[model samples]
Target: MTRYYRALRLQMQPCGISNHAAAWVTTSRLRLTLPTSTSTPPRLQACRNSRSISSIALNRTNPPESASTRSKDGRQQQNGTCAIRPANREFSTPSKVGRIYDPKMAKLWADTPMSLISETGYKERSDIPPGHFAITAAQNMAHLHNVIIRGFNASYNQCLAVKPDTVDASDFLFYNQGLYKSIKSHHDVEEDITFPSLVKLTGVQDIMDKNIQEHKDFDHGLELFRTFVFETDPKSYDGKKLQEIMDIMFPILHTHLVGEIGTLLDLAKYDSKKLEEWWADTSKKARGDLDVFQDAPLMLGCIDSTFRLDGDPRPFPPIPAPIKYLSKYVLEWRYSGRWRFNPCDTFGKPRPLAFPNPGGSKL
Candidate 1:
């Protein structure tokens, strides 16, 4: 074994992940096959017959694409990393194979016509870290996903509900950047802060690996979605084309959005005080990561539109009073030409809903 192999072994053993195959699985790029039972950690093993330095497993770099994966038209899809699955896995869901393309169905069920349900008996509970914080984070992330999806829907409906024609490229660009930065920025911080903190506290290194993989599974989709918006000329922009890309991207994104809540709630067994402390610290990191000019307006606006200060037990980080004023009036105005496409108002209230959510009357 080379010195690098010995170093790798020394680094991982103390992390509680170097027991066997689990160690190899955590450090390597192999797809994890987690057991149905949560109690048992997955088994893995590493071999150290290093003929060369490159032969040793290292932190994964984005893998290269294969010739066999080209579209029949002889062009590569913008992000060629996503592999489509054949209809064969016994345990896989429909989304595992490919998207079920039915705009009507998606709108009908998931994004139903808005019928205002009052907070008649909604009781907010106090949950300590791990579970409480986890659920809250999941809920907020899901809310952000909903806001983005609805914004896209509204933009599409405005331009092409009845027919497709010229779209406002400026609007599309703004929306694309807003949505992209919002989701990506949130995720980057969580990966940087929460996952590592949780691991340190619990001494279970692989606990958050599943969530990391979920983020990975959707990367190509986001890339394709972004590329389609940026690369296509506004004059040539087709609503159907946008719909198609969204259909390709959203199923995986949606699953990740909601799936993470349950995964995090499972961590309640850990130390609550430490988890809570970590949540606050991680939140600061997330807030600090937000760029005042580019990302602040979209993120703050979306949060304002989705999360309620009055009802939500945990208030999201507040924009300091001075920055809040400047961002709301000056900075947001600079970049928010496309907020007309947003489903909710800057304050998080429903502004007549949007395209996907049938604009229903209030009681």
Candidate 2:
């Protein structure tokens, strides 16, 4: 009698993954084993995809129950809706965005609306859940890409402007530095504060390992972009080099941002009360470590530019009203030269486009 041995495999593409890595602890590794005659090949074919956005390995051992996060009745609750249902484990964003290489065109944002993961009724609900927050966060992350892309397009246009010499490269470099640091702060918060809390709250082991791996995947390009920004003299800014880096970095970022959001539905398992508490605590602590005076101006500049009233998809993190007034009125004037390229005023209101729109359309 002949016997078969089936194996699982994980394949990573040769290009686009990053070089400099944060601490990546691989809890599991894919095995390539010989299969028996009875084993079918279809199973393997079903698993392969570009995004690597599959759900956590469900086969892992689930711990014994601690308490009923559920109501007296066993049904789950989600986003103020009663009798919550299990997320269809197989649910995935309909498109395979990882296959695309350009962030500007990937259209991943089109697929990751907050409503897809949480109850749509939350839009009307006076209160929203953590899962809802994650969905909005995902939308905001995708929007950040557009801000970066717009900045790049503006630079490209400047290079082609009727009189290129009249344009100052140093001023642009200051703008780029501010933009880069803002994104860096956002990601730093995720890796340091948010992911760990989610892992504990969700009660899923190694749940965030893949997210960390994805960070490692794109962080190399980001590091290169950073070096260029800080090392290159603003007086002799290299627009060509800047464009080249943006093209390389955007697609990798798109894949990670959209893919990470797709998994947030899993957080819906925790009760809304628990979810809200975790987010509130985690968010408050996330940025507490940064130097406020030196760092916040640039970060606020970038965040404010991409996200503004009625036009933006989500609200800004709850900054106190007094601080908002001070940041806009008191602190931002120091950086006025660099901020001239920004799409908003110091108070986070939309401003006229500083660079000419090549397609001659509204931003």
Candidate 3:
């Protein structure tokens, strides 16, 4: 699959096809059938006629016909809207109102208004029943790391979408800086405070050794990524090069980010009280010295409060109401241009990408 994806990417280079089209081509082939009479496969056909494939991809972004409207029969289908109807109503008759809930048909968000952050394909750490300390702590870490993942992907995709000659480089420069600072700060806190605290709490010297080594795996790539963006003058800024750096770093970074959550979940075997103490200390240290203007915007811009997991929407980062208000109203103004590439609004509402690739999914 990886080799085929790579081959598709190579084919895309000359065609100037967007990532969405490539993904569509790749995934569609699994279920799609073509005329055996055709000499060229549809995958190659798309590359040969880019505009047709682009149009097909763009059409997918149109609002899907409502679930009720998609029934094959002429009968009106009962959907979420039918729940509010009177129980005695003819249309609300239980026998005729069977609703088959398919996880495959479900959406992560109730309303998808934009090009969503690419899914990492890693299943989220499940919520512990009644919530263990491990689950609580891991949830916090997962949310924080989620911000990094989405922020990085949003920045990466936008860089790919826009030509260097067209957009101002400063926006990307500052945007990259925000992504760099947030990710770097996260790892630094883990290594300096969180990991040591874990060892002390568990009395197991290498309790967090694996996670630390995982951090090291991507540290150099992340540093190089950071240095490249910060050091490269905006006059010579290359979005493509920035993307290349991200391409190398993000996979390793993503693996660590996702794997570490499982590590925290494994800590459920430890005493809850001690884990809680460690969490209080580490979480405090993590939030320490936060630059409201810089950090808060990135968090708000990346989080989608509407994203539903375990049948519930996730609230934003647990901060004071005043802090949330101040960050949304005032601090966000500082890097307002950079946030144009952000996947969400100040209130964590998903919004259309400011620079979506041509024919990309706008959901």
Candidate 4:
């Protein structure tokens, strides 16, 4: 075992992943103590290493296709079907094809016919009059919810698109886990941090009472859906059963997601300064605490970089360019295969679905 680990470390080093970083990912679940280093913190080191290894793993695993498999548009053709192009093909270029927000992908991006939450008629921060923060908060809330909804629909539609026999269950399940974890993590923060903070901030003890109850409305069904996806063996996976479970809960969940936007908008009645403080603090906590391995990638992969807001492109999330670049080039490689199911690419541009509906189902 010692010799094998040494060999693994040697191989990983060429990819620019340090020995300590490799250990962090391979034994992530296990607690380990190492001599403290001044260079980088443990968590950051883990993230950097995971990114390097993921890209190396992807490149090593997916070999170049033969000239015969190349299509006129430069995508690979396999068994007469257009195969998902390699992640590296358009690594430095924005995709000119595939639009996640298009009418064809309505189920993924739209809450109602022709209505996208990202482009919804919410007042901008600058447009708000002095001290009025409700509309800004609501827009931010809507943006976050829209991403989550897109991820859920992406996973749901992918399951529906491919035949069960042909689907890669591991990739599907991991992607589902990312979506599941993202939603659960966000709600957990709300229940544990945001809700209580809001009650104190507004002096309305039950400001989020309806939302809390609504969370209960679909909690069991969501749990069942999560269990069905993760616990079920790949060979025994039943697509129909998965759809049935989602059908029972997702409508209720979607209603809650949309309704929460209204809830934020209604905060106009509260003190604007207090509301702004709550949003600022809570948003920081939420962003800082995301699971870098899963939730971060899931969120980044759902955003639409080209989807402008108030004529400003890439305005959502409000992350800096350096972090965004790291996220796209490095962190995203952590779940490179799982992200294949996401509606948008790592940089948030819409791309062709890795798994498309075989019968051309209008779902």
For lDDT, candidate 2 versus 4, the one ahead is: 4
State each model's C-alpha RMSD to the native: 22.4, 26.5, 19.4, 10.7
Q: Candidate 2 regions off by >4 Å? A: 1-167, 287-295, 303-314, 318-322, 357-363
**What is candidate 4's TM-score against the reference?**
0.68
Among all candidates shown, the one with the greatest TM-score: 4
Clashing pairs in 1: 20-44, 21-44, 21-45, 22-44, 304-348, 305-348
Candidate 4 structure quality by residue, lDDT tens digits, 34-127: 3233233567657645654565565534345899778666655433122335332232332222222444342332222113454334454344
Query: Model 2 — which ten-residue stretch has the worst lDDT?
Result: 4-13
Query: Which portions of model 4 show Cα errors greater than 4 Å?
Result: 1-131, 163-167, 287-290, 308-314, 360-363
Q: Write the per-residue lDDT of candidate 2 for residues 220-274, one digit (tens) a residue.
A: 8888888877887755665656657766776676566556654554455457567
> How much lDDT does candidate 3 score?
0.57
Clashing pairs in 3: 114-362, 114-363
Alpha-carbon TM-score of each model against the true structure: 0.55, 0.53, 0.62, 0.68
Top lDDT prediction, candidate number: 4
Tens digit of per-residue lDDT, candidate 3, span 1-363: 334434533332211123443454345333223233413356654543563345456552322357555434432232221111111111211111111122332122212221222222224545443456776666666666667777876776666555553334677777888788777767777777778878888889998888889888988898889898789877677767876787788667777877887788788778888888887655544433344466557777777665543334454354334334444545666665667777666656555556654444232
Score residue 263 of candidate 3 by CA lDDT.
83
Residue-wise lDDT of candidate 1 within 78-194, one digit each (tens)? 221112211111111122111122232323222322211112111343343324444544454444444444444444444333222333454655567666665665566567766
Predictions in order: lDDT: 0.45, 0.44, 0.57, 0.60
lDDT of 1 at 220: 88
